[model samples]
Target: MSFTFFTPGPAQLYPTFEKHLQTFVSEQLGSISHRSQQYRDLHKFTVDQLRTLLNVPDSHAILFLGSASEAWERILFSCVELESFHLVNGSFSKKFYDCSNALNKYAHLFEKPMGESFVASEIVVPEYAELICTTHNETSSGVQMPVAEIHKLKQRNPGKFIAVDMVSSAPYPELDYSLIDTAFFSVQKAFGLPAGLGVWIVSEKCLQKAESIRNQYSIGAHNDLPTLWKNALNNETPATPNVMGIYLLGKIAEDFNKIGVQTLRKETEHKASLIYKFIEKQPGFSTFVKEKANRSQTVVVTNTEMPSADIIKHIKAKGMVVGSGYGKYKATQLRIANFPATSVEDVEKLIHELGSL
Candidate 1:
């Protein structure tokens, strides 16, 4: 049976996804050679659509990678020579920090309990840290660090390159590109696309840093920043990329642009409010994150009184699906994605099912 997915990451498909996919297949878009002029046009179209949809600056170059996880390793390897700092509040943020450590970079972290958020004023960035990593929205814990707070960190540490992992909150964070040196997100989350493509947006300054330190560290070979940047200048990639994913992303982004990003954001906020309000009154549930201001508008996590498995099964039977909690909270919590692909009507229906539970 077909079900509307409320799961984070590979959540519900964009409303126009099927139509676009059918057209792409019929047109044989996937068979195009990556090095051909046809492919470069496709590449540029996607990047242009994304820049328009997300308000990305012209100074930033958007490059495609395997996944947001890979971008974590690339950013550390290419940009940092000695030290990096991270604000960790959940699994994903912690994983970015872990990636840095795995890469042999001296990774420093200011960690908070899973459901807590960070305050910019309280963060003490190490002077030796070359790049500062922040997760705009923690998908694992349903906590969001305000974009303003991120801007404050950048302002306070003008010398440090700021990287934001907007993995699950892309096109939603409304970040000021001038403030951040780099940011990334995977297509599966907010873009509502099939998983596989990771979008890394890097500033010219970040590119310069990677070039200066390229010989100093083993910053990879084929997919290194310099290599990626060189090809991206021509609207291409060093290696063959997910052409189908890029096509769908461009089409969907074009759809989003036509609908207007502001309209989508307002709809997302409305839907999030619906779910949070329902959780507030539901007998067997409470929001995982306590502070409303810090709660994520994209991924809403709730502490369930009953096993999350039971709750998930209950909802699945009603023709809908939601995500189980991450890691340790697997059995005790539920995550509901309020991405643009999931409609307000769908959210209302999901709430109705939860209310019935």
Candidate 2:
């Protein structure tokens, strides 16, 4: 039996996803070569739709990659030569810092407890650090770093390149692209598409940085920033990409555009408010992120008084699926995705089921 999915990434598919996928398969769009004009047109359409939906500036180039995880490595490799700084609050943010360390860069972090948020005024970037990384929404902890805080951070450190990991909160954070040097998100999350495609948004300055340091280090060969940017100008990729995923993303974005992003954002907030308000009154359950201001609107995480597995099992039996906690909190938390694909009705049903328990 098919069940409604509220799992964060790989969550419920968009409402019209099946219809679009059927059209894609029947047309054999996937058979087109990446270099073919057909594929280029598709590529340009997806990038343009995303740019319009997300308000990405012309100065920022949109490049498709393997996944958001890959984008992390690309950002570190292409932008930072020696030093980088990160704000670490949860698993995803910590992993970005780990990527920097694995790349042998001098990565420094201002870390906090899992559910805590960062304040821009308190953050101090090292003088020699060339890049600053922040996760717009911490999926694991359901904590979000406010866009204003990110802008403030940029204001304070005018010279540092700011890279945002919007993996689970894309198309939701109304980020002023000018304030950030780079940002990325995978389609599997907010876009409600199957996993595999990652969209990386990089500023002109970041591309120039890659060019400046190309001769100094092994910044990557094929999927490097310079290479990706060069091909993106022609609406193409350096290697074969997930053509099906790209097409579906464009169609879904077009759907989002028709509905208006502001309307979607407002609806997302309405659904999130229902979930958060339910958590407030639900006995034996509490929000993972204590501060209301820092909670994620896209992924709502809650601490359960009972074993989360039992709660998950109980909910699953009723034909809806939610995510268990990430990492160590696996048995004690519930992660409910409040993505654009999940409607107010879906959330209401999930809440009704939770209320019954």
Candidate 3:
């Protein structure tokens, strides 16, 4: 039986994943050395594809790392010298705040309830905080901050650096990269690929800031922004990287490119609207995020009348898996991802089965 995963993050597999893997092994992409010209070509190809796909600027350096969590650590340690302000909305966003604190920076926050988003105009950032962090999508709660709100934040605080966590929301609701200093995501979610790869896009300003403080303290060995920036200029990493993930991502990105981000965005909106409509009509379930505008276009979280696990089991029995609630809502909420790889037909089928239950 084929299982379709609706759970967020490492959710569904890209439709072309199998063919790409077979070719990956046949082409021996894994065996190539990091320093080889072949590896450089692969790296450059992926970077170029991502820059075009994500509308990334030439001023930014694209680096592949371990995970989004690692990117969180690097961003805080490298970009901020003393303090960083965070717009915390859920578990993942809070973690970024905690990460900066763990590194001994004075991290301030304007925290909101889960499934709630911030009012960008109402936020007051401290003058001392060097970086302002915001999660573009709170995967755990399915709350999405609008692009206009982020632009407002950037406009209000021109001097402060902005870092956005687009973990589950990238490749849709396209961002104007000029407003933010950096953004990062793991391919496991939106890209519909296997895990273990995190893409970090950092602007030139981040590189200069890190270099200025490089002698003051060490953020990390090779993964530091300065090193990642220096090495990426040559289409390389400071260490042996995820060659396979990079290749798969580039190929998958090419597929998204062919389809176009605007088309994917429309498809995402359509699928998400269907799921939300079903939630409203269904007696046993309700959309988690109260305000429709704050609801995430990528990760759709619903509150079930019965325990979420039972609902998950009910869905799983049919060879379909939906995510259980995250953190405190574990038994009461379920997360569903409407990523690029999940087709409209598949989503309609899933909705049909869900309605029957």
How do all models score by TM-score? Answer: 0.99, 0.99, 0.98
What are the RMSDs of all candidates, in order?
A: 0.8, 0.7, 0.9
| Model 3: pairs clashing at backbone N, Cα or C within 3 Å | none
Off by over 4 Å in 2: none
Q: What is the C-alpha lDDT of each candidate?
A: 0.92, 0.93, 0.90
Give the residue spans of candidate 3 off by over 4 A: none
Candidate 1's C-alpha runs over 4 A off are: none
What is candidate 1's lDDT per residue for 117-174, written digit by digit as tens?
A: 9878999999899999999999999999999999999999989999999999988889
Q: List the residue pairs that clash in candidate 1.
A: none
Ranking by lDDT: 2, 1, 3
The number of clashing residue pairs in each candidate reads 0, 0, 0
Pick the lDDT winner.
2
> Per-residue lDDT of 37-72 in model 3, one digit per residue for the tens?
999999998999999999999988889998989999
Give per-residue CA lDDT, model 2, range 262-308, as digits (tens): 99999999999999999999997899998888999999999999899
